[model samples]
Target: MQGNKSEHTIQKEIQLALSKHKCSVFRTNVGKVKTIDHRWFDTGLPQGFPDLMGYRWVDNQIFFIEVKSQTGKSRPDQLIFHEFLQSHNVIHGIARNVKDALMIVDGGLCGFGYD
Candidate 1:
């Protein structure tokens, strides 16, 4: 348990660092400030995806994450989608664990905390 906790903390740190770096470089390239937070999709199908979505401007790609501070707190639809992504070996997210979800985005495939 202690080991897991330590590892989680380390992961969190790396994620934060990478996110900050990515955001900084991204903003510079766009020549704009103020990163928009959270883009939602309203499927109007009883439930929807929203926790967060990022648009990779250069590549015209999208990345999604569900994001829950606690694993069990995830919405049903999110759970379903999560499983689907896993099974298909596709990329999607449980959103985030906090206001700032640390993830390294590369080639439309995101690394869960840089490793």
Candidate 2:
């Protein structure tokens, strides 16, 4: 049986493409952080932050991208976050692959991968 590409691979491709296209992008690392001085670092980031955050220079648009594999789906928390962003007029979408991600960067539209 043919299997889908790993989400990690897709995420890497999306990041590379965005960078290649001159979009200022970065991945969001979610977890706990403790400094050597026992200083706890926590911003209390909400759940379901997108995998990639970037600013597309062409339109001067900021975006949030949630990457997933062919068979992957968004979690409840992700959907909630999406809605929240929508309410705030933030650009965000779910990208199932490089193409989807690129499209999001182009226009922030969740064409085929978003439900």
Model 1 lDDT, residue 91, Cα: 44
Q: What's the count of clashing pairs in each model shown?
A: 7, 0
Model 1 residue 99 lDDT?
A: 34
TM-score of candidate 1 on Cα atoms, chains taken together: 0.40
Candidate 2 to truth, TM: 0.80
Q: Write the residue-wise lDDT of candidate 1 on 1-115 in tens digits.
A: 3223342453354345435544311111111234467564443432434344455445545555544443335656556655655566554444234333443244344324211
Model 1: lDDT equals 0.42
- CA lDDT scores, all candidates in order: 0.42, 0.79
Per-residue lDDT tens digits of candidate 2, residues 1-115?
A: 2146787888898899989997988988755689999998875777877888899888878989888877888888888888888887787788877777787777666333557
After the best TM-score superposition of candidate 2, give how far the Cα of residue 103 lies from its true spot, in angstroms: 0.9
